[model samples]
Target: MDQYVEILHWNTQHGRKLDAAIAWLRKRAKAAGRMPAALMLNELQPGQGEHVGGELGLLHYPAPVDDGLDPADSRRRNLNAIFIDPDGPLVPDPEWVANWTGPWMPPATLPVNLRNPDGTLSSRQLYLACEHACYWHPGYRETTARFYTVLGKDGRLVHVDGDFNAWTVGRAPLTLANVADRAFAQNRSVLCGTALVADDIADRLMTAGGFVYVHGHAAEYLGIEGADAPTTDHGPDKERQLIPEEDQPERGLSAIDRTYTTAELIPAVIDANVITDPDVDALADHKPRYTRYGYPDLVAITNLPVELVHH
Candidate 1:
């Protein structure tokens, strides 16, 4: 998606290639009688160019994203949310913005938005941020941020971006040392800590329903499979009822594995929201370690109905 969007942004054709690709995608989905776009888009160059999202009938962040800075400026990196589809909420986050060297610039950071035009908190969720700019960089290592979720007036928290404390969060040690945790520890740098920070943020910005519908992958890691099959109860199971057995897997997980700077984020997001532990209940209790998060059950993605289960 980033590649396609990038082409749309920089290519002389602009908007043309992305439109073509979206057309192809919609065509395929229509032919199969499946949802056309379960999309999560990011790195979307902020602007109203073509508004492909609107054309495809996807819900968007609907806030002004321009930070009023040069596109080359790092502070304005995520000022705009390119796209936000419940199914495709995940976006690719290139640690190396444009300077993609293994480590070209240390402190590779940017800021995020905290409010909307109506003054309602603009942050729909936390996966949209990283620790304050003080933490990113070309030097990938394993230390967490002093302010894990965000950095504001009092330096209360540290996250990808935000200017104020939209809400309050407690301070606690997150030495879980999970997979991404270990990688950052070994390398002395890891974005996985962002998970903990985002976990905390999602607690405030989201509800159980937000988690229920957010089944899309970080990038194109669509959570489609018999295990992850969309569990819509009433309407119709497009992937199953309309599509054939052979084509079902395609609707499930794509052969393209390395979801890149993305795939890791999906599970990270799950870890933030759901209780992966195969014991206890999600809707009944929160993951003991996390507060104000999780659900009654952590069943396969396909097991739940396609309705929003608001918290």
Candidate 2:
């Protein structure tokens, strides 16, 4: 039995090189009364343009020895032999397997509208809801905001919320009070009996005007506590002084400073009624203390009754 076979530099323009090669090998195997364990077809000239040819290969192994098995069943038994045969020297490398298998078929396109019959929310709307929740706060070294998506009965994305925390400079022990105080200092004003941080988020959502609030404890929602104090970089005062002042919101400001700026714009977030407690239990049931990637963290307290059409 030949352990290996090679078909080198065959021109593809001569037509169906693989079929021709296989046919030639089958005739050789029939003449020899045994099949080659592996076949290596190298430098095949798939002639079309100015480009050169590529390589192609194939491998097959004989089935396990069994006196009871009929000789006619040998090919069928050996169909996957190359991959499983321990004694076979020719192993199917990933590239060789992939080439043999050909390219994967593309997945079918999903329906354009992935909304429930009630038409309350579309798939796109649900995705945006998650994004809005995550994007509300900008990333900072001292603060971390992590959001999670909530699915409805239909397994579509429906709601999202986050676990947010920020470290602050303070003498008090790391209590919720300290965190709330820091949050308050950051956004300077309270609205509708909620903390300044909560008010800021509420305001942004209200102005956009689509999502309905079921229940939100703005204090707890925007609360931060028990975080380590931010370390000060003790660079030279002269070098620090040389840094010019810039109006960019993310630059040269503490979390508190940014929150205070949001407070100044509190009037923009009108309609405090937009923040309501319709299904408190649902909110509590869905809200999560922590979430891993791809899981819902919060309750479906918020609903978007209409789809947004972007211009």
Candidate 3:
């Protein structure tokens, strides 16, 4: 089945102002008999009560409002109240395929294409290209202003930081395919896992899920170490060290190739695992696990594509 997300309003006001807007939309939505399915706010994490939105600073969608945790919680609001038949009117007619012929379609073919009643060829490639230019465009600042209410949660856009303590060797491999697959296979239930446990992977997954990635620290693209970079080793005297690209084991490629910032990475999600340069092998060989040790909700089994998930 195909899904649609409606941003009810996109107000730019941050903090309490955004909260008030959300409250207003919920009341109207309820009155209109359109219950929300999932919310895609600009804040980063889920939380309880109004304060949670205030706390996150609105860089990304705040965490889902837990009904059990706060039945009265209004923050976890959704706007995609209208559901359409995945095969008809909503999708273009040219994209529709008969059931017998649909199976032969490529994985990249969209569900909408298989059943669109509009008859226009809804090219998946075109969809992605448009989406990239619109949502993931270079230096695009996402906001809930046009689609959702502008309650008080507004702040800076959040990004997931890939730079962990270099000595944090015990960390698991990162991928979005693993988490999305599990979420889909497991019936979209929230899998229990800590923020620190598969931290890098989860951040990426959340971004795929349409939330802002809030990497608290700065990230260098391509894993290149800049001058006066801090040593990632453990123990005392682990001071900042200037290292060459070839000599820096932590960095896998040339500094010129370095462009791995969240700003760059989110849009280039498809390229995350592809071995463009011959030198980088770690990402090429790694197959992400569902639950490494105790961590659950690992996203990728192998380097899988996570760009533009259709949940």
Candidate 4:
């Protein structure tokens, strides 16, 4: 029942550290009655400071001969994979998670929704009002900035980074129009954070016969526990009694006090593609997997395929 095993190498000795780690993992895998399907070695790169590691090489253990080795034995081949530690400097941050307040700078304008004088879309609106309602954690700001840029460029649609905020924004008459435009461009599949948003977006888009890629919360959809979830700071008004309950569950709900940013969303986009690589699609679509799983603490990662159940 040992489905997957990952080994992280951090020896500054470079090649030697990698070799040593692989050897150790091989022995461990053998004892566990498991054969490595692939061995990926990630070593530190040059001048990446001491934190960075190199390429993550994958070593898959063939069946039978590679299985059932003693954990204490050094020659054991019971390994799912033998690779360097994932947490290295060269690894890029995931776009889905948002940015950490590192040395990176913030965006010039807060990408948000525009509003009219009546708190709705104006017949003659001048500038788009970016929704400054979502949560911007210290580290996740970088992600928010990037998301804003993408949304701004693709003005035809409203890229709702599915969290509570998207609903709040969608409820806005003006913002809803943009959402409708994008949804119509695609099917009724605006990438949503959760099925909740996905369904909601689909309904609204359907009103105008429109849709977009519904980006759901990978953590929830994929059953990834302990992972961080995106959030925002906006919510529906308590006194707005005209809206139907089924029409808008998020109306009464509040915005996420904290949320993920664009810096994080990028890597997520990659990882989702990699982990969900189906029918050997991963062979060509595994780069994001390498970058995302390169973190040291991440032992086993799963990229759930965007299946029908998820939708």
lDDT of 2 at 117: 30
Candidate 4 regions with alpha-carbon error over 4 angstroms: 1-165, 168-215, 225-247, 250-311
Whole-model lDDT per candidate: 0.26, 0.23, 0.23, 0.25
TM-score for each prediction? 0.28, 0.19, 0.19, 0.20
lDDT of 4 by residue, 1-311 (tens): 12222212111222334344435445644684542322232222222222112322321111112224353432121111122222211111122222222222211121111222233321211111111212213223334434444433311222222222233234322222234244332222233463212223322332232222222233345444322222221134322222334544343422221122222222233222112323222122111121122222111111212222211
lDDT, residue 173, model 1: 21
Candidate 3, residue 15: Cα displacement in angstroms equals 5.4
Can you write out model 2's per-residue Cα lDDT over 1-311, one digit (the tens) per residue? 12221111111212223454445545654685544322211112222111111112332221123444464542112121111111222222222211111111100011111223343333332221111111123232112111111112122332222212222222111222233235333432223355333223432332233322211221123232311111122234324212123321232222210111111112222211111122321222111121111111111212324343333
Error of 1 at 46 (Å): 3.9
Instruction: Provide the global lDDT of candidate 3 against the true structure.
Output: 0.23
* Stretches > 4 Å off in candidate 2: 1-125, 128-158, 164-184, 187-204, 216-310
TM-score of 4: 0.20
Clash totals for all candidate models = 27, 9, 51, 87
For TM-score, candidate 1 versus 2, the one ahead is 1
Distance from true location, Cα of 152 in model 3, Å:
33
lDDT of 3 by residue, 1-311 (tens): 22322211121112224444445445645674542221222211223223423432221222222344343332222210111223222232344331211111011111222222233332321110000001111111122111111110122112221111111112222222334234322221223363222222223333344443211111323332232122122223322222224333443322111111223224323212211222221211211100000001111111133344333
